[model samples]
Target: MPDPTPPGPRAAILPAPVFTDPRVTLFHGDAVELLRLLPGASVDALVSDPPYGLSFNGQAWDDAAGFRESIPHVDTTAMSAPEVFEVWCTEWAAGALRALKPGAHVAAFGGARTWHRMVRGLENAGFEIRDQIAWLHTTGMPKSMDLSHAIDKHHGVQRTDRIVQTSEHDGVLGATRTVLSKGTPVTEDAARWEGWGTALRPAFEPIIIARKPLAGSIVGNVLSHGVGGLNIDGGRFADDRWPTNVALDPGQADALDMLTGTWQEGSMSRRFPIFRFEHKPAARERPRAYGVSHTTVKPLALMRWLVTLVAPVGGVVLEPFAGSGTTVEAAAGAGYQVIAIEKNADYLPLIRSRMEQ
Candidate 1:
């Protein structure tokens, strides 16, 4: 994902590191700027969580609003313009490519809505599109708008009352009546939107996985660079149960056999994970972190598993957006070295604190 634009003056590298542990080193600067300092084909893999451009809660790091929420700004969604965000992704992915050895893999967390933009940018930056791993979990918090409130504001309705749904005696569409407390009336429009809401309940997060194009054959890539190819055995489950034709309907399975003649052993393309993770613990709602806080805190168990799945033992991992240093902790715990980068200086302390933990 090299930049096409002409290069400008580079930032001066400091003489020493900001925070360093046995397995982790964090740099306080822009990811693209720091990425250029690494020699090409140096990193083994990348595990990171970049801003989803949702402008989540108007946080400064989320790029939603300028500085802070109270301060007046254009209500920008992401930290920058749409074009700028796209460029940012492309540039960083390019930078990741340069830092990563050929045939290295990248797994990045992204919002379901905007992740496609990131994926396209990565592909454009010359990474091969691998399977997108879905981290299934429950999320009760939603960003959808409340239509009832909007209707009230539009009708200039103001009152100090509570919503009371009581089974009152007769009148107004049978016994059960939904009335604003104190018998306050609601417009037909307002009543109509009481239970209606926008957007689906977000239930899953997408981890876009990709790999830098290999230098040659898979064997050559592994032999020369000790990268490329996932640790299938490490990532594989202990149970033998795996992908089968059960997912298809019985009739459909039969139809396929009738159409293409009876299938034989080894007919399937690849094995799918038989065991599914409800991720109830991870999916539960949590308060949004604000100001200097990094809202998205990936579970350590999940991060460690992902690291083991992506990188080999003692391999180097580069995390571009190392918010709170969860990646660093996971890497170090999983026996890998990590280079973490964060743009906002505020989270440096938080990252250090978490890595220490």
Candidate 2:
């Protein structure tokens, strides 16, 4: 095997690690700054869920100073907000590239509205574009505005027929009750636009799988670097079937089984058991000591599967945008040394709690 490369400039000047164990290390700082501080070609794989620049639920980090709208002095003449977001992505991705070993793969989760921009950034940052994995879920809430309701409010019509509904959800940010729709449309124009909304119900999230340029041919790279190739056998399904690009939550898998039915081959009879999301952020997965305040915590099982598929055994895994420490937690649990970096100070406690567990 080839020797690991030496650390670059500023690699030694790392922020004091907030949490560290034999298997896991956590850093609290900017992702780009922390990523550049890592030794060159040290990390074996990267699995992150970076910001989508959507101003999602008015979160400040994802907004990046109102990234959706063009900010002053940024020169938005030639580039739109989405293009600007792509540039931001390229900056961090380039830093990630310096830290990753040759042939290391990245599984970065992206939003449907802005996935293309994120992919473009990764491509520009010297990573080869690989397959796109889709994770379908049944519990997707749409952030759409009702056009009919807006028209009614504009006309100042108060509908007598009003029904109040309370919705309780256990999401990344913990459990909460949301009251939806105070009233329905009342005016003629509102009636015409009834049932029309601004957006569609979200069902799936895309995970872009990209790889660093290999040092040599496939076999040669895998032998020397212990990466560049996926762990196909290790990632096989419970039924001993090969994995697919499409993943589904329990609800979606059950629905598919109902729609398409099952198949039998030889001694095995099983349903369409593609890659199912076996791990979720339920009471079992997350540490009960810390309340989950992070908005975009991915399913723990999904992250585990991603790391296992890409990273080699006993290799180091990196998560630049370590929101709630899901990626690091997954990697460490799967027996890989993990480095997690998060910028938000408030979330440091959350990541540390997971490490303690």
Candidate 3:
């Protein structure tokens, strides 16, 4: 890979490209800055998994409280976390709007709790709201707290029917266990909410698809800009089934099969309404030895499908939030011109390694 110095005119506002090859360019900096610096109407598509504003695992990058402080001219003191995140998204989405060519699309992943805020932000930034694609999975760990357990603890009552449940993961270092209550609730408040938890297990993540306004008609725009159209044939399933808005992992597909009573459509089976993706256990458990440790690494297969769906053949794909570089790796590996911007410098090495592969 070539670490070429940026041109003199852009060097003032832009840093040198960290890793630049014929197919890919990696930058180490804030996404907003890079998005602003990109040449207007130059990028063909935008696909990324930006921050979810959930402060996941206490990671500062995902924390909206501190992120709000960095948005210039925005007073976030009284704003809630989700509200602040909307402002942040609008800021970058505006930059993206300027950088993307007319009729290009943006495929962004968002948290379930704050997906509407992201959509609002995109709409606020002048992008036309398109359909939302659901990335269905069954692997999300529930973050709900047990109401009965909390009530019992607050009342100072010790339950004797607590049991430890352990599950070992493949390729993981050790087993993870949690305490479960099996005994009757000792307090009235505990008994009232004995079987209830705060939240349900997460089953799906929303992937928002927004598009820049077309210069003219869709056919005219595609002819002029080489974009503004989905690669449906490229994204088609086996037996020429057109891809649906729902993308499913193996677990989710299995669940849907159970619910609908079949998977593949045949003389003996019923057809389901899903586009099943290749299973990727490695997406959940990345190789720590390579220093690839982004907490929310997306499945490479899903990323590949997304990039192909939005971007035209051999066109430029911009990934503003290249966490773990899955989108970047997918875009580049699939033979598109890629520009990957990552805010956290710690993951740069992992991204470069992925590009080399």
* Predicted structure with the largest lDDT when compared to the true one: 3
TM-score of each candidate structure, all chains considered together:
0.74, 0.86, 0.88
Rank order by TM-score, top first? 3, 2, 1
lDDT of each: 0.69, 0.80, 0.83
Per-candidate Cα RMSD to the true structure, in Å, reads 10.5, 5.4, 5.6
Model 1, position 324: C-alpha lDDT score: 69
lDDT of 1 by residue, 1-357 (tens): 998999888856533558898888888877766787776798999988888866765656656332233223223355445445555677678878889998999988888877887898798788998878766555435656557766777898854575758774642123554555432326678777776668877756788889999999999999999989888667654365432212222223334445787554433222222223223323221212233445677766567767877787899999878876778877888889988888777778877766655
lDDT of 3 by residue, 1-357 (tens): 876976565354678899899988889987766788888899999999999888887877888865775585788889888889999999899999999999999999999998899999999999998899988887777888888878999999978877778876633324566676467788999999998998999878999999999999999999999999899999886557888898887667767676876545431122332266645446442524353467788877788889999999899999988877888888888999998888887788878777666
lDDT comparing candidate 1 with the true structure = 0.69
Report the C-alpha lDDT of model 2 over 1-357, residue by residue, as the tens digit.
Answer: 876987666525788888888998888887766787888999999999999978787787787554423234345557766787887787678889999989999999999999998998898899998899999887777787778877887988766666545447665554544536546667889989988889988888999999999998988888888889989888888777787898888777767666665522311114434366853456555543355477677888888889989999889999988877889888998899998898877788778777776
Off by over 4 Å in 1: 1-15, 64-80, 163-185, 240-292
Residue 133 of model 3 has an lDDT of 92
